[model samples]
Each structure stands twice: as structure tokens, then as C-alpha cells.
Target: MTGTGQALWRRVPLWGVDASLVALSLLDAWINLYGEASPFMWASAALGCAGLFLRRRLPLAAFLLTLPMLVFMDVAVAPMVALYTVAAHTRNRLLLAGCALLNAAASTLVWPMSDTLSGEDRTWTLIQFVYTLATAFAPVLFGQLVQARQDVARQLVEVEEAREHESALYAQTVLARERAQLAREMHDVVSHQVSLIAVQAGALQVAAKDPQTRDGARAIRTLSVNTLDELRHMVTLLRASGGRATELTPQPTLAELQQLIANSGIETTLAGELPPGISTTAQRTIYRTVQEALTNVRKHAPGARAEVRLWHDTQHFGVTITNTAPTRPSVPLPSAHHGLIGLRERAELLDGTLTAEPTRQGGFTIELRAPTHPS
Candidate 1:
């Protein structure tokens, strides 16, 4: 029963096999008495046949019904069949062993003792008794072992499936966070530049001079190219898959400081060399801080002069941006933009510190420092 046909046979309920086995056992027992059919034999036959009905559901109960009949006659047909079913189906080892002992005891006690009974006859009887007991007991223990192995296999499969599900959930969470980070970067760069371009275009349209118009057009062209390049770079990164594609775009570096200053509408100055060996994350953070500061400058204090400085030692990369206060009597206060809060969060996430305070010269200064060494 190891192939596909065996698998199909296991599912089939062989009612006929159970019936035939019960009937043959009873017929042999009746004929062994060597007389006309007696009422006890008829009663035993009916009990044996009826007991098979409960074989699948209640094997132990059927076995108990046949136990008493075994004491009356050496040959009991239904008891052995019912005991075999019990040993195969039941999970109780103790109960199966007890049933086997009872059958052996009955077989020994029921065999007639007469002058004709020889020593060899008793020895052969004992051998057959041992063989019957072995048959009755072995199946139960084997069944238990098989069931245990199956249970362990099922539990292992469940554990593997749970691990895979957890891994999938973690992957989804990481992908979602990366997408949000990309969106924030795009919004920061595009929004700031577009606002500046709109203002310059409007100013150029109203100007009476040709030189100012040409300058405005040039600034507009520069901003447009910068926006297009950033967009293209982001799209390429998003489309990339493997390790090689990751290094395709030129990474942002401190060398881009001059371009960052040129893009500012407010008058700005850069001082000192940016440190080497700075992480890409730190560089981007520095750029975003400066960008947001300049955006706030244009919105809060027009025509303001700002100074940006990069200073680094063996331990830290430091950045500071400070703007002079407006000359007019009424200077606009900084708006409630979420960009400053976002910068602070970004700094904290990188294990860095950011501080912003009003300067003694009636201006605001923002400073940030991050450690280069990993702990």
C-alpha cells in the first residue's frame, strides 16, 4: 500500500471484508465443537457480526464483547478480529496490552485438560498463544510512532510559513518608507526652485530694461535645467534594480556648493572647504537645510544677505547658515512651514544635532553637526 492504488484503497470502507471475516471465524468455532449447532454458538455468531458495525468508531468496545466468549472455547472468531482493529486504530497502548493479556490468559485456561493431552501439544499451544499476543500488540505501538512523525512534520511546515509571512510584511514596510523619503526629497527641491522661477519671471515681465530681462531669462533657464536634471536622476534611481545601477548617477558631493549658492535668490556667501569622507546622507541633509533656509529668507526678509560656512575636523562635519535682518522697519516673521521640523527630524535620525536661534545682529542662525565615526 505504497502507491496511488494503495492510497485509494485506504479511503474505501470494506464492509464486506469485515462481515466475511466475522462469519468465517464464528463458523469455524461452531464446527470445532463437533456437534449440532447450539444456542450459545448462535448467540456468539450474532454478537460477533453485530460487533463489526462498531469496529471503526468503537474498537475497544467491540473487543470487550468478545473477551468473555474466549473463556468458554479455545477458538473464538470475533475476538481476534476485533482486537486487531483495536490495536490498529486506538491511541491507548495500555488498553491494547491489557486486551492482549486477557486473550492469552483465556486461551491457556480454556483448552481442555485430558489424559490424551501430551507435553508437545501444550508447548505448541503456548507458542501459538505467544504469536497471537505479538500480533495483537505490535500494531498499536507502530501506529503511535507514525502519528508522532506526522505531527512533527506538520508543525515544522507551519513555522516556515509564518517566517515567510513575517519577511514579506517587513519588505513591504521598507519599500513604503523608501517611497515616502523619495517623495519628500522631490517636494523639497522642486517647490523651492519653482517658486523662485515664478517670482523672477513676474519681475522680468514688468521690468522696463532689456539687460534685466536677459538676466532674468538666463536665471530661468538655469533653474529649469536643474529641475529637469534632478527629476531625471530620481526617475533613473527609481527604475534601477541591481547593485550596478545604484552607482550609475553621480552622487551629490560637497563640490556642488557653488551651484547651491548660485541658485539662492538671497545674497549668500560660502566659506571654508567641505570635509572629505562625508556620507551621502549628511551631504543631502546639508543641502536641504541650506535650501530651506534660503526659501525662508526669500519669504521672510527680501534682499537679505546670508553667509554659509562648512567647517570640519577629524570628528565632526559642521554647517551654519546665518542671514542679516531686513533693513526696513517692518520685517516679515518666518512662516509656519513644516520644512524646519522636517530638517530637525532628519538630523535626529542620523544621530546628529541641529540648533536654530536669533543672532545678536538681528538675524537668525541655524547650525548642525554630525559625527563621522561610527560607535
Candidate 2:
């Protein structure tokens, strides 16, 4: 059948199908036993038709219920359906073969006993028995074929899903390789040139006689150093793409927090200290949060004074960075605006939270809170 037709057939209620099969079996019984006034024959036919309803739930018992009708009256519908149901639901080959033999015997031998048994009659009876046995196996084979078809379809679906998953992983692997290549170029070429520029500017600042030239050279050296710091962080992030947080290496810890604040170019004060024995991941998270916050203060709030406060309670440890409003006019700087987002992502990996908002005093505050022993 076509896919659409098969889907519609599956949507039909199961009870409705069972009821229809029962009605068909009853009709077959009536046609075979018409005009028979025997109450015993009618009862047997009624019982056989009723047994069809239980074929799916109780296949063996339902087939046994229809045996009497096969022996007394020639009825094939109910017995064949029950045998098919048994074959479809079970994988016991010996049981199915025994059922087929019983079905053939019950149908071939009628109820009435013949007093005179001739050799020709015996030969004819044997032929009929063989033919009946072959007929009984027809539904059994068909039911098994249907069961096998359903199994193959289910296996095909699983294979397709696995193929799609493999394809997705392959794509991610290719993208990560590209990002690694880009990071290598940035570190090898761009970082090397920037380091040389910083060195040249420092030498010029020392050798120059004019005050203005010395000041310009000093500014260039500081900017170059800041750019190199940002570049190193970017390279680390690119190298660790498509992996877990623990894969990130060469990460800064709380020990570097003092150096980070001093190099940030903003007037920043470190207020408190965290207890020792913290995990590397938590320390990195705290360090990144403070780094990003200080960077933001220097960029967007010029000449701002910032304070870094580190505190811990019994359960949690965190850092808060608050900066005063800009004292000088701020120059607009081009920004990708991903620093806060990266900090938040790192905090989440350590089961932490980060919040950045404007304070009522016309300044900005960035805070990070995390569990001391994160899993």
C-alpha cells in the first residue's frame, strides 16, 4: 500500500478492526451452517465467532476455542485468523508447527464415524489432510512476513538518525579546525608584530629628548601592551572551541588578579582576598569576571576609579567590581560587545551567576557569585 493509505489504516481504531473481523467470521459461519436446526452446531459456531475477538490478547486460547467449529462444521475464517495472530506475536517455531498440525487434523476428520473403512477412502483422506496442512501454513507465513517488515522499517529509522548525528559531528569538527587555523595565524603574525611595536615605542620613549615625543611613545607602548593581552585571551578561546571548559589551558587564576588590575589602565583598588584551596575553574571564573569589568570601566567610563571586592561566606564565594562615573569625556571605541557574554558563560560552567547593571550613583557594577565546591 502507499504511505498515505497505510498511515490512514493505522489511524483506524484497533477495536473497530477487531469488531469488523468478528462480524466477517460470523457471516462465514452462518453461510456454512445455514438451515441447520441443531442447537449444538449453532452454539459451536457462535463460540468460534466470539473467539475471534480475543485473538490478539489470547491467541492460543482463541485458536483452541475455534477447534470445535473446524471439527463439526467447515469453517476456515476464525481458525485461520487465530493462527495468524499466534504467528505474528510469538517466535516459537515448534509451537506454531504443532498448531498447524492440529488445525489440519481437526478440519480433515469430520464428527460422524464411518463404519466401513475402504483403502480408497483412506488414501483420499490422507491426500485431503496434506492439502489442509499446506493451506493452514499460508496465514502463518504471511503474518511472519508482516512482522519482519515492521522490524526492518524500525531498524532503518534508527540507522538514519545515527547517520544524521554523525554528519553533525563531522561539520562541527571541520569548523573547529578552521577556527584553530585562524587562531594560529593571529598568534604567529599579528601578536609578533604588536610585540615588536611595543618594544620600539619603549626604546623611543627612553631615547627621545622632547617631552611631547616621550609622552606619545609611552602612550603607544601602553596601548600595544593592552592589545597583546586581549589577543592572547582571544587565541586561548579559539583554541578551546568545541570542547568542555576544562580543556581551556593557560588560564589566569586569582594570583594574577593584582597584575590584571594594575595593567587595566584604570585607577583600581583590590579590597579583599579569597580563601585558598579553590578549584582552578572557580578561580578562572572570578578572574575573568573582574578582568572584563575592569576593561569595560576603562573603555566606556574614562578616568573612572574602580574597586574590586572579593568575599566568601560559608557556602559561596564571589567578586564584585564597582566603578565611579567618568571624570573625563569618554571617546567612542569600536567593540564587539562579547566580553560580558563570555564572562557569563564561564560563570555558568562553574555553577555561578554574573550580573552587570548600572548603579544609582551613575556608575556600573558587575558581580559574580559561585559555589565554593562546584561539581
lDDT of 1 by residue, 178-256 (tens): 6556656666776566666756765665663787676777677577667767775664454221122233466545667
* Candidate 2, 55-87: lDDT as tens digits: 888999999999988877888889999999988
* Candidate 1, residue 46: lDDT: 62
For model 2, what is the C-alpha lDDT against the true structure? 0.82
lDDT (Cα atoms) of all candidates against the true structure: 0.66, 0.82
Candidate 1 segments whose C-alpha is farther than 4 A from its true place: 2-4, 7-11, 14-37, 73-77, 111-131, 145-375
Candidate 2 stretches greater than 4 Å from native: 1-11, 37-40, 112-122, 198-229, 243-375
Clashes of 2: 0
On TM-score, the leading prediction is 2
Give TM-scores for every candidate, taking all chains together and pairing residue i with residue i: 0.40, 0.55
User: Residue 374 lDDT in model 2?
Assistant: 74
The best candidate by lDDT is 2
